[model samples]
Structure formats: structure tokens, C-alpha cells
Target: MFRSIRHRLALFTYSWHAIGPASMLRNSVRWSADAEARAVDSGFDARYGTDTNADLTPGEADILIDRHHAATMYLPTMDQDLAAMLAALPWPESLRRDATFIDLGSGKARVVLLAAMQRFRQIVGVELSPRLHLAAVRNVERVRDAGALVSPVRLVHGDATAFDAPPGPLVTYLYHPFREPIAALVMDRLVASLEASPRPAAILYCHPALQPGFHPSVFGQRDVFQLAVEGGRQTRGFLLGWSVWTNDAWLDRTTIPVPLVSGAGEA
Candidate 1:
């Protein structure tokens, strides 16, 4: 058949052009080493995979609002990507010690574990999928028993749109976990919460390749950065973007101007 020949030709072209035998051997070794290092560094099972088997029944259709609005696919955050994001943020020890960090669509709760390890005042992970939520609970226990988690943490098994924001300044994180409709709803809720409480808040969004125009309207101007990570044969770069928005009241209360000394060095 023509399709069969085309598939064979495509495979042959890919093997010769993209991943040859030599490159495959080298990449395998590199990938193995990277995986081992990551497993040791991250106390949870943070392997990257998808939840393609997610099932939504007719009864649950009301919650999901049709299949298209259902749960987003599951993928664990890479440890290096998390590091890169934290590096870009204005994360002082005082903030980490006092802020409540929440992760929307917290699959496997890897970021929650990271927050716990960082000694955040409070750590919360909201996940809609029952499967991933259970996995997150187990991972939480594992990390706590290992003494990697130093702060109090909780895992909420529910829709992110319905979750309530905690009191205090927040560090909200999103990993491109859902469609725009759901994300928009959740973000609007968060902004409303901030407006009500008037606190400083920041949102860390990773893999924001979808809906480039959505963030500005929600989070205002976000600082964008690139993270270079190795895929198979070569290194690939991804966008790690975040924005900090403070309530007017919170800013007025907390924003203090730095005192400028004139001719102090002349003395």
C-alpha cells in the first residue's frame, strides 16, 4: 500500500536524519544517568508520563462539563525546571518561611513536596483526577517519612475551580494543567481572592505555549524565561514564565521605599 511505503520511508528518514545508531547509544547512556540523578535528587517518583486513560462517565459529565473540558493530561514537573523557575523568582528565605504555596492541578504533588522541602508556611496541591490525587497522597507520605518535607502539607482531591484560596500571601503555581475555560475560571477566582484579602501573590506558569494572549489579561505583564532541557538527542528549550501581582491595599501596606543616602561615601 502507499501508506505502508510512506511509513517505512518516514522511519528510514528519521533513523538516518534524526536518531542514528551512534546517537541512540550515546543518548541512552546520557538519559540513564540523568534519570538516576533525578530520582536521587527528587524524593518522589517524578517521572514524566501521561494519563491518556482518564475516563469521564456520564454522571461525571456535569462536573467536567463535557469531554473537552475534562481533566488535562498528567505530566510530572522536572526537577531542573522547578529549580529554574525558583531561580527566576524573588524568593527570599523570609517569603518561603511565611508564604502559603499552592499548586493547581498538582499531579503527583511533586511541587508540593518541593514547597514542603523549602519550608513554606503552608503547602497545598489541588488535583481533579482521583488517580493522580491518590498518587500524590502516597508521595506526600513517602517524602515526609524520608524527612525531606519540613513544612506542613495538604493534598486536596477536587476540582481546582472549586478550591478555596488559603489566607496570607500566596505563591500560586500552574503547569498548564487545563483548558482555557477552566484555567480562566480558576484564575479569576484567585484574583478575586487576592482582591478580597489584599495580599501579595505570584503565579509561576510552566510550558505556556498555549494561549499566548491569556496571561497578560490575568496576571498582567509576566517575566518570561527559557529553560534548556535535554530531550533525546539534543537539548530543547521551554518557556518558564511567571508574574507577580500585588493587591493595591497589600502594596500600600508593605511597599517601603529604600532610603537613599547622598554623599555618604564622601565622608
Candidate 2:
């Protein structure tokens, strides 16, 4: 617990240095209100709070940090921003009905619940932290009991890098889940899956890392994935960037809409 407090303090210090005090204050006020409203509307605890890794046991922390090179903290993606990102995708309704939606590093399964409300064939959330996974399970149960889920939902308590995607059309979502090494491995796994199955696949990356970048370029082979949409939303003046990449064989580039950089909430 002491270590977690220190880590959070260090993160706050860095954010204070990077964005200054006024912007930090504005974001905190606005985001807290938004989280409250979302929680009330959704009937679940999907608020922005705590780094999930902070709750990890010492042995778990050591193994994750030392062996995986994955240490990105958990922050729920904004409901509005995720909706805009999905709206930007030019997929046909028929395709959406056939494709499975998967949220990688799905903390508390907020994204999974949102996707469940969509027309996807199924919804899956892969989370590494046991603490977050249990919370997600509870939330899923609540959604299920309330009959709010349009599609079936599954929560997997496991590492994102090793999760094998089901074969067929897929829509994978990520919210800057991890560092470059693990991100690269996840991309490799996706590429291999596409190669073996040769199906339509799209990747939705929200709040992409800017430093030591983890973008579509991480896919390595430029011929496989193409950047279909690149945009973001501003939450009380703080920019949240997102991008969509489609497999080369899947999308009809001519049919895709121009990048959404305004109104929908791009800064």
C-alpha cells in the first residue's frame, strides 16, 4: 500500500510538471463529474480511480514488471469518446452483427459493457489484474441482470499478450494498455491470427501512447494494416487521441469516411 501511494504521487508529480496546475485542476473537476453521471446512468462502478496495479500483491507486481515489461496503469475510457471512435468506423451494420468485439486490458470491463450494447455478435474483455477482473465480473452480472446487454459478454482473467482471438471477423479495442514491448507482442499475435485466418479485422486504439510510440507502425509489416481513422476528443480541454486500423484485406478504403477531427470532439 505504501509503494502504491508513492507510485501514485510520482505519477501526479509528473502530470503536474507536464500539464501544469490549472489544467490538472480543470480536468479533475470535469472528469469526476462525468464519472459520477456515467455511474448513475449505467448502474455500475466504472469511474476513473486508482491504478489497478496498485492493488497487486508484491509477487504479482514483481512478475508483471520484471517478466512482462508491462506497467501501464488503468483508466476507464470515456463513454463519449469511445462512442465517437466507434461511430467513426465505416463498417456496415451487417458486418458489425457478424464480428466479435474484444477489449484488450479491459479494466473493470466498461468498454465490454458498452460494446455489449452494440450489435456485435459477442463481447469479450481480457484483463490481467485479478482485482479489476472481479470488479468487471460484478459489473457484468449487474448489466446481465438488468437486461441491458444486447450481446453475450465474457470476461477473461488473463494476460492480453497470450489471449487468442476467436477466428472470424473481429473488432479489437485497446486504451493504451501497456508499454511498447508488450504492445508489440500483442500486435504480432493479431497479425498471426489474421494471416492464419485471412478475415476482416479492425483495431481501435484509444489514447495511444505518444512517447516511445505505440501506433499502427507497431504492426511492423506495413502491408498488413492500414490506418483508417485518426482522431480524438477533448474532455474539458484535455485531448484524448484515438486511431483505427483495418486489415489490408478487410476494408474498402474508398468507402471509409474522411477523418473526424471536429464536432465529434477532436481538439
Candidate 3:
């Protein structure tokens, strides 16, 4: 309860600082209504037999709070947004079949479960919070029992910074999992992994923090990453955007007979 209050207060303070009192209040009201509507299962949960609708704040998860945790919150990726992200990947069907799909900071493994429905080589969810990791385990089991998973799912309970990307083609999904500090660490790890074992890789970042007040995303490394898709739409009064960053190696390999798929690159 106390943590929940603190979390709310922090959000209020941040919103006030960012948009002032009046606009903050207006956004708060609209966001609250939208959140409430989302809380109720809209057939996705019913069909999958999963409980991923709750917004699990750091406080609600009973986890230690740090600068990174404080900035992070758990909201399952919207079904439509995840679908759009998958669709935006430039990899052909053959490459996608051999690629591993990983979701960092996968809260309750919602994205993990959804990704399992695809024909990836493997699906992995790396989560830092123990509580959320356990929840993710249960959800994965439920999905497995229901025979809904095409690719085997693995849930790792650990920090994203320490996650070692398996060799071969990889696709990572991130939903603003942490602030810039932690994000930088995760990015370094990924770069190291790619360097150690050179391969085609891509990052799908939903609701990327690219605005002035927020820290810049590591995906902006132009020398290493090329913006493949950049677009967003208004959802429940909130403008949600996603950016797909493909490593230079992917672009280099696909430059020939593979035929590069076109998308709205970064301006």
C-alpha cells in the first residue's frame, strides 16, 4: 500500500514537472479511464487463459526500489502493438524461423507467450523481478498446457544487463524496460554478444523513450543500427510509437539477392 502511494506520487510529480498542473490532471483522468478499460479482459486473456491485464508497479511487486526500478513499470504490451512490431521486422520467413525471439523485462511473459505462437527457433523472456518471473512461469505453463505454443518458451529470472544473447540470428523486444542507465548496460551486453558471434539482429522497441525529457535510446547508434520502421498512432488519447532498429550486419547481409524490405526509416 505504501509503495503504491509512493509510486503514484512519483508519477504525479513527474507528470506535473513535464506538463504542468492542468495538462497533467487532464492526462491523468484520461489515462485512468483507459487503464481501467484495459484491466478488464478483452477476449485475449479469455482465449489464452492468461492473467496479464494488471499493471504491476515496482511497489506492487514488493521489490527493492532503485533508480532503475523506480523508472520502470509493468504494463503488458498491447496485442495490436505487438502484432505491428512483429509485422515490421524485415527478415524473411526463412531467417525468422531460425531466429530466437527474446523479450527483455517481460512482465508476466505476455509478450513471450504471444511470441511463442510464432515459428521461432526459441522464445525467451528475461525478467528481473522474482515475483513477476514466477507469474511468468505460471503463464507459460498455462499456454504450454493449452498447446498454444509453437516455439518452446523459457523464462529467465535475472537482470537484463547480465543476459547473454544466444548465438545466431536474434530479435529482441523492449517496452522501455528501464531508464537510460540500465538500458545502456543492456545495449552494451547485446553489442558484445553480437560482436562475439556476428549475426543478423533487430530490436523492436515499443513506446521508445526518444523525447527530450526522457533519455535517448541506444537504438540511435547510427553506425551500428539502422532505423527500419518508425511509426505510431493515437490509442485512447495517448500517442504510442515504436521504432525497429536493425543492426548494420543485418542490412549488409540483406543488401544482395534477399531484396531489402522498405519501411519508413528515421527522418
Q: Which model scores highest in lDDT?
A: 3
Q: List the residue pairs that clash in candidate 1.
A: none
lDDT by residue for model 3 (1-267), tens: 997787788666555544568776656656665565466535678887877776666656655665333346677887777889889888899998999999999989989988999899999999888888898998888889998899988889888888999988899999877766678788888887776677889989876222222244576543456788876656466666788888866547645575676778935
TM-score of 1: 0.63
Report the error of model 2 at residue 237, Å.
3.7
**Residue-level lDDT for 12 in candidate 3:** 61
TM-score for each candidate, following the candidate numbering? 0.63, 0.73, 0.82
Write down the worst ten-residue block by lDDT for model 3. Answer: 208-217
lDDT tens digits, residues 90-156, model 1? 6567865788889998877878877787767889999876767887788788777777778899899
Deviation from native of the Cα of residue 14 in model 2, angstroms: 8.6
Once superposed on the true structure, which residue ranges of model 2 sit more than 4 Å away at CA? 1-69, 208-213, 220-222, 248-267
Model 3 lDDT, full chain set: 0.76
Better of 1 and 3 by TM-score: 3
Candidate 2, lDDT over the whole model: 0.71
